[model samples]
Target: MHNESIRYLIVPGWQGSADDHWQTHWQKSLPNSVRVEQADWLKPRREDWVGELQRVIAADSSPVILIAHSLGCVTVAHWAQLAPLDTLRQVRGALLVAPADVERANCPPALRNFAPVPEHLLPFPSQVVSSDNDSAVSALRAMEMARNWGAEIGILSGAGHINVKSGHQRWEQGFAYLYRLQGRIEQSARRRA
Candidate 1:
């Protein structure tokens, strides 16, 4: 990926990326990276989430590479359906880590209503990472969501929800997967060239 066109946009789930969260570390470490700021971090309304993401995307000057975890991934998928066709086309790629697709399956009771997963496949290349032992969303559901979205899958061993509470800190493998997605985006660009 050429540094010029590359813009990293991180989306944290629920209560937001905490000080010790890996997503926060990644945003701090990477250049041209920022997380989509939501108005209310505690209670997440679907439209509110979509609106915040839309605003972020609109404010971006260049194409974006999104890194979304848990509910943030859901927010991205939801926002895709509402985004302008050109803005949707401008999203270069995405890395959805531990996506909670069927939130109604086994997640927190409050999140159960986030069901009926959107039928939007990312226009750009993307990857969905899942964990075998994620209690929030089963591995089967994760794979199912990835298939539904036509995304590549990366199954991890036992990371529950792949969050800070799950004991994930400075996840090197996750970063590697992001790099792989970046490569895929670069290859797609080359193909178009």
Candidate 2:
């Protein structure tokens, strides 16, 4: 499918992207994009977030490209793990940015339940983008995640969590990364055809 025809599903982490956050910037700027609303962002439950993702994906008919950040990335992993193969096919690809370390000892209580990060390859194409100095995830673990998920990885120089606090507001580089991921999806579909 053409990029304009694909739906870009925004999946923000924790309290949701701030007004000036890069994810929010993309949501407001991108066409055919929608944020997957969660019943509760502050106190997230694995089942609730995963269910919401499935709901939004199932609700829409157009093909989708997931734009997930931090805990939102983890939510995608959980949903993908449980979603049927047919349902999984609807998602062309995903840009998982700065996946939060729910397995870490110092992780927030609310984000702790998402631990034991899914370690299997996702059926669809994916890319894991992280920063060299992100407090939430280290380079080693981020590489491990990419390896496990069968995804390509990108590491920025000293760009701390890749969020507003990290001075990544309106991150053009990250947006470019997401745009390129569409090419991988289209190539995969063509191969299947």
The lDDT of each candidate is 0.83, 0.91
Give the lowest summed-lDDT range of ten residues in model 1. Answer: 101-110
* Model 2 alpha-carbon drift over 4 Å, by segment: 1-3
Please write out the lDDT profile of model 2 over residues 19-133, one tens digit for every residue. Answer: 9999999998888999999989899999999999999999977788999999999999989999976679889899999999899878999999999899989888999999899
List model 1 lDDT by residue over 1-193, tens digit each: 6676667899998789998888998998888898999888777888888888888888866889999988888888888777988778779888999887554544565555556677667677889998998876778888888887779998889888888888887776688898899999889888999
List TM-score per model, in order. Answer: 0.94, 0.96
Best candidate per lDDT, number?
A: 2
Q: What 10-residue stretch in candidate 2 is worst by lDDT? A: 1-10
Clashes of 1: 0
- Number of the top TM-score candidate: 2
Clash pairs of candidate 2? none
Those runs of model 1 whose alpha carbons end farther than 4 Å from true positions after fitting are none
